[model samples]
Target: MRWSIPRSDAVDVLREQLRKQVRAPFAATAGMVVLLWASLTPSLMPRTALFQALLTALCMLAGYGAGALAGWLVRSCGGRLAGRARVIAWRVLAGVAGIGTLIVLGLSLRWENEVRDLVGVDRVGIWHLVLTVLITAVLLALLLGLSRGIRALGRSIGRFVGRFLPAAASTVIGGLIAAVLIYELAIGVGGNRLLGALDSSFATINQEFRTEIPAPTTPELTASPASSQAWEDLGRQGRVFIASAPTAADIGEFTQEPAQQPVRAYVGAGHEGVDIREEASAAVTELDALGGFDRAVINVVTGTGRGWVNENQAQALEFMWGGDTATVSLQYSYLPSWMSFVLDRQRAQDAGLALFDAVYGRWLEIPEAERPLLVVSGESLGSFGGEAAFSGAQDLATRTDGALFVGPTADNRLWSRFTEEREPGTPQVLPILDDGEIVRFADQPEQWDLPGAWEGTRIGYLQHANDPITWWSPSLALECPDWLEEERGRDVSPNVRWIPGVTMLQLGVDQFSANSVPQGQGHQFGTAPVYAWAEILPPPGWSDERTDELAVVIGDRAWLR
Candidate 1:
């Protein structure tokens, strides 16, 4: 029983098994081509070699599947390569794959260095490239093995069913059964369990209060002793926001003038019995209690999934207005922004509509001339939800005094409409809708200075050209975007090109690293909001000089954060 095959025989058998697992010559060639394309494409942010390897592997797998399906169809229709021809085909493909991989790896290293230099990250070396290849090979082997295992199971089922039915019918039935099983395992049961676990984990995270962020003692902030909302009930981000409000003294020091205490009202999703609509109503009530309606300016801010209001956006408004402002927001989900963007989008829409409608309804009750200047603002996923409250540019102008939406997602309805209808000569990155009469897009501070008399309520969208949140789309898999077709953004690499499936994977991966770069690039807005607000809702004596001074202050403060 302990006796076994000789060592050489075992090695030979293992080698033969591995050789059999290799895909067909044509399919392998197709995968090599896709791998080269994916590795060579420019990314929005500087990607580590590990991420690049993963992206290339996934794209190669897709190409291999497509090529294999094509080969199967051809053979089924009575096409075949003879023995000598098949051997020659394999030889040619081997040469092509080897040469192509070397060339692509070299080019990828250069491109990666270029992007790293642009974003101020360290350049990768030969070791990273070696790691990339090793990881790619390992990932490809695992993925291919899994797929082949599934195929083998299907074939076995087909053989059993063939006993009772025609060969073709049995094969079809077996495939359908396999597909159903995969769906049930991967999505129906597994997906629900995974989501449930994530929800519970994030919910627990929301309940935790960090020692660094203490409850606000000021009457002007929510969850204070003078406020209606309980301190324990505010979620983690809500507590941070409430504690981060600029006091009257803080604003006065910056403005060099007397200032009022800024009003900040927030409602957390951690409240047990409060629905979103009720939370919205409670937020308005908190704001009213703090005399928010009496302020010179009022901003209804739509927060990201976990209710994170941007400090840059909020503080810019407060400082510029001498703390004569009120900012209000409500938490809607416990998930992080990206997960909520994919899974809880409908909740975001509902939260945005509810909060805005509730606040707007109450604002209308005041006499038109006596009401505070109303405006709306959001960033990233928050921008996606914020846009849901408005139909288009005209709805924005009519409903509010001003707006500043930063890093808008690709699915933002109003943003897409404006970009689509932009003036013919303008590029997609900085589109000018209706000749910048109302809504306008800006990347730099100076782009706000468009010609003609800027009239009515000003609405500005601050989007960085390299921000994947603003550029990623499902359409990227099949079609080229205008941003890539036109001149590249100031920060984006000129080498960036559109490769059907490869570009989509590049951008999708880019999102994970978007915020790691310096401000004014990727998804970070930095002091751009200071410049945008100066245009959107400038103070009585606001000037370019003042905006410049404030930008410096904001930049300095951001470094501390």
Candidate 2:
């Protein structure tokens, strides 16, 4: 101790700081190894030497500062107080190091708002964060426990070693133990963090594939003609994005006919539905809130590009495109459901009568007073079921009351022709999310056209202007000059439909993205307003005067809550 000299010279300062840096990291590493071995570290550490250095340095700084203070306080306290103070000090220091480990884990995971205030906007990859947290926790817990053990064992070691040898030998033994701890710490770090960090950070991250999606590959969004003009590539409305493919064909089983009686309809047996058969992608997503119905059926789903009926709680019907690990893009929802193919009109008639008899037994044969209200609704396939349900309800001697048809190219035309007229109900659309906040989108009429199929019928349209998914193409909206500036019936609300809710949910929110190219705006990115049914626009970004028929944010702050 007398031989050692303390100096404040620049050279000395650098030397001391360097030594602390070097030794502290080794100390920290040794602590971590022991902690990890003890199953007490908080998170998994990066397998790089640089990451190890950073971790070791932090732990060392915290541990040493606490240890020095404790040593000082103990010297002053002189006895039992010193021993207790030492324990308390180590506990506090180790606890802090453990917390630091958690913070590191948050960084690794990259979810900025996980703690909201602590981290912002960095969505850490889920697995990495989890792994890091687990490892760090194990490390920290082990360190704390080891510190306690060290305190307990140090005195015992001193007494036993001192009795066996000369006092000098005891000093040698203590030094050897300290050296072994220090050596273990020095060897544990894996070191790539420090190396790669020397190069450009962005380069490293890009090369790592740890940030951002790779460049574009979709033909619909490449150097082709489609990329030349401004076109919505994929449109995501809520959880659904119905991007009209170049290969779009009449996937609907029914054919379209002109509207009659203000709301024309078509009727087909078993699978005759599509009234306004236009093609884009159509789908339905039953999310958290929409899980209200146990037996749920979504008509004209934008994602599946087909009608879905969930009879029992099982997967919906789908077009078969075989593969393992289906890309959500190509086959969004490929469900399995029962379907009967009627090869000819005669088959439909035969099945219709026989099916009617069976359905009649359950629907009509049951006491009319005992039956519950039936909900009949559909676009294409949905319309077929609606018709059968309506007919079945009639067979049961209970008149089918409320019926709504969407994209009714067939059913609406026929249903309107059959129904006897009564006083037309004034359209009752509700905007519950706001007081008087109105969202105006171009291609969407002033009053916003409700599906024409609603005329002379109790129809409810869950629409946001021209939903391209149900065939109201952006091309149609664009062609209809002053589609926005026109009166309600002439352009927007066409006399028979209503909106029960204003705010609509994003189908697959943050998940909405398109394969992008290097060229600016070449992204036929699946933007909601730009392509899909629910042209969802974010809060107050698009103004009143601007009308692109794009989704505009219309609700109040409370809607978020």
Candidate 3:
């Protein structure tokens, strides 16, 4: 009581306390900036590209400014909710926010007719999505609470370790332990549920929409030299659909000779959804049985949610080759391809390796003179996985005769590498590599107008400029990709412009809407498959007229999704 400070000293002490109080919001703002920067840096910032780096820096700064604004908002509202009245007010505010969110979601559901058409579902499914979001939010809150407890446990351990070790070291160890615990919990509990919530309702309805295919009849299987023992055996071997070339009598007027009849074999990934490798092995064996050695074999890897090969591509190959080609494929996953990639990319990659390896192994056994030219093809997520079979152009050249990956995802490693390392003046979407020798990217067949006869094993990627699958990436949240500046795909809206975060969010929505348009005309590549295949494997007697004719036929035919 006797130790009274001087007035000047007391004023200084008060100022210090005020400064400390003011520091809290600024510190929080700094932390937010760090978090957002760390999250976005991996996607936005490329090591070599100057524009990407500069743009990423700007994005980081913008995020920091947002964080600052949030900090100010938090500080302004800090002491408003203190007593009983404040508590009640908070409850009212939360209720208002919830109602507002629901209203917004309802409006969105009403506005997004294109998404409804694309997904081929009704309002009930949209309502399910709303429920999914709410449930997911609740689960996330629970996880956050659990994480807090875990973090406390980690801190307690750190305190204990502090007695035995240096403070910095103990703190680091504790943080690492906490991180590991959180990661394990995320995987062990939340991973499956989180993924399922994305599209489970839609997938359920989609599965219901699939038509039940009948197994091959005894008469059909035993139909003389025209009937394939392998094709008939597929029914017993558990394939979903086996469409062998119809005999002369079966096709009636449409029948060309037995030599011109193509063999198409496909097996489902079980209605129950079993292992991919086993199914792939089974598909390879079926390919072998169905005269794969005698025909130019195209082993296609079907996208997730697709139960069959790209019918147009397969049919085009058969048509171009005069029925001297066979296509084999198997279902890998039941979830929609976009969802599958988000949930379990490794499965797709594994399927690609297993199927390709099995076919290549079998293909090797045949004598060089008699061995059919082996080719690989895939589309969308199918392309992403199929590309995993090769490390680069050299690897592709050595492994397969020719390959076609249509609508390739931006993350495809080989595609990215090739595009990045292409010769100068080459466009990002359709890069001409090594004078169109090893591999070339193409938006259309006309871009492949190289001088003289094209040399080397051909691997073409057909990515439409407008395809969301080809361009969507986390980086779009910050900066535009080069593809946007160059010639846009025929279908892409001219009004489409890159607006940083807005564009990113818009494209995410566009992914759902893309399927509303007809295939080939949009991302599905409609009649483009016939043209693409013709370029990749120029069959004997193939002409522009023939390709155009087949394109028309393929467009007219119904294909299984």
Candidate 4:
């Protein structure tokens, strides 16, 4: 029922197809135009020349493919300009693309400087722009060459198959086969190997110590002289966490009153043959030994992938409660937060649920009146894990005295639900849910103060407007988020425009530099926890001035570790 090409004719057809595969000059010009537009688009953070080059090159490649496909479709539909008209069209497009690219580059430099000013970073010079152009040219050439090679291979397969089948059938079948082979080789096997290599490398790094961070000697800290957990057993981050706790002296000096030593218990992921539940149990044992349950406040904190608890969050509560606090955490993975967010997110959820349940069960054993105020906290991927332990806002409010989740990832179900159901007229960045009765979101310290009488179990989410961790979603490739459509956040550039797939790429690259900016912008939450905790559950007689003073103190000493 199907006609197949003869072997000799198929060879000739293949040659013609390969020859015609060469992209028209107009296609490159179209790509250049799109590349310029992508370069000028505003991002969450001010990018370095290297990052700018990468962004532009990637967008240019996408544009080139699109333009080439459009040309192919036009030709297939029997559309063609005459010799003189084609030449004129090419010249006009070339002129427009060239002039447009130069103008956009000039505008991009100004926009970059503006972003730097907003984020309090140093500005880039004209050299940066020059470097971006050079690097982009190199990257674009390499990408185009690779793309052409892949296309050629696919076409060759189709041509070979055309000797035995119809042209359309051959092409379709060849494309499908090539796609499957590429996916299997590149992702199924190569991706797994790459992840394994990265995991091994990061695991090695987790065992090493920072030059500045020595193991703790205090009895109240885990991995100390009197502790059951060994110093060598604690991973790098766990060691840093134990060593960075505020001492009685540090808290006493700030409060101008005698302070108790804060209890800190951490279980590392590096322990051999131990599951998450056992790790959590060991943490509870350490907490019990350190008299954590006897403290005025107990924080069941979730650490990021490398077991990094924000010192600001931990020390803020210590200083606020005059060191009468206990904080416990467990490491889930050796890979950094970003890597674990993609590969090992389920481990984080398991760790959070196990640790919180273990601690909550112990707390329940004590008399209701004698129980300390239990609070839950985490940041970024940590927040994603922490939210998994609870079903929704009601579960969080009922189970814990208060909670402060900072820079929550877009995957956090409770956070997404709250943001989606936020009151009308409220912005997505700083949503006011249920009139701030139980749960609230804030971009700054001052936004915590809501009107009317505050009720039970206050929960707060500290999110920056430019925090890519909180805003990035897969849906970004197709749909514009409400945050971009509404009145922009104070830190976000007004020039930011969402361009379907291009905006997704922009935000994807933005994640790398999220924490490179100053404390208030991007993913950095400097001194925000001090105010967040103050509003959630301030100590007796706590005042705005006191919160201000503590913020200053913590800002000075928090990053010492």
Best TM-score among the predictions, by candidate number:
1
Please provide TM-scores, in order, for all candidate models, with all chains considered together. Answer: 0.93, 0.21, 0.64, 0.92
Alpha-carbon lDDT, every model: 0.85, 0.27, 0.61, 0.87
**Candidate 1, pairs of clashing residues:** none
TM-score order, best first, reads: 1, 4, 3, 2
Give the distance in Å from residue 66's predicted Cα in candidate 3 to where it truly belongs: 3.1
| True-structure lDDT of candidate 3 | 0.61
Q: Which candidate is the best by lDDT?
A: 4
Error in Å for residue 242 of model 4: 0.6
Give the alpha carbon lDDT tens digit for every residue of 1-561 in model 2.
366445657678899877753443223443443332222121111122223333433353345445444544555566333477756756665776677656554443332223222211232345644554455455545555555455345445656788988865675475467546644554333123322232233222212221233222333222123222112222111111112111112112111222111000111111122222111111011111122111112122211122222111011111010000001111111111111111111222232223223323434444656543332333322333334433332332243323333322122223332321212332212121111121111222233332322221132222222221222222331243122233332112232121111001110110111111111111111122222122221112433333332222111101100
- Which regions of candidate 1 fall more than 4 Å away from where they truly are? 1-17, 22-25, 156-177, 271-274, 558-561
In model 4, the runs with Cα more than 4 Å from the true position are 1-25, 160-165, 210-214, 271-274, 558-561
The lowest-lDDT stretch of 10 consecutive residues in candidate 1 is 552-561
Candidate 1 residue-wise lDDT, 286-324, digit = tens: 999988999999999999988889999999999999999
Candidate 4, residue 416: lDDT: 97
Number of clashes in every candidate structure?
0, 71, 4, 0
Name the lDDT value of residue 503 in candidate 4: 83
**Is 1 or 2 the stronger prediction by lDDT?**
1
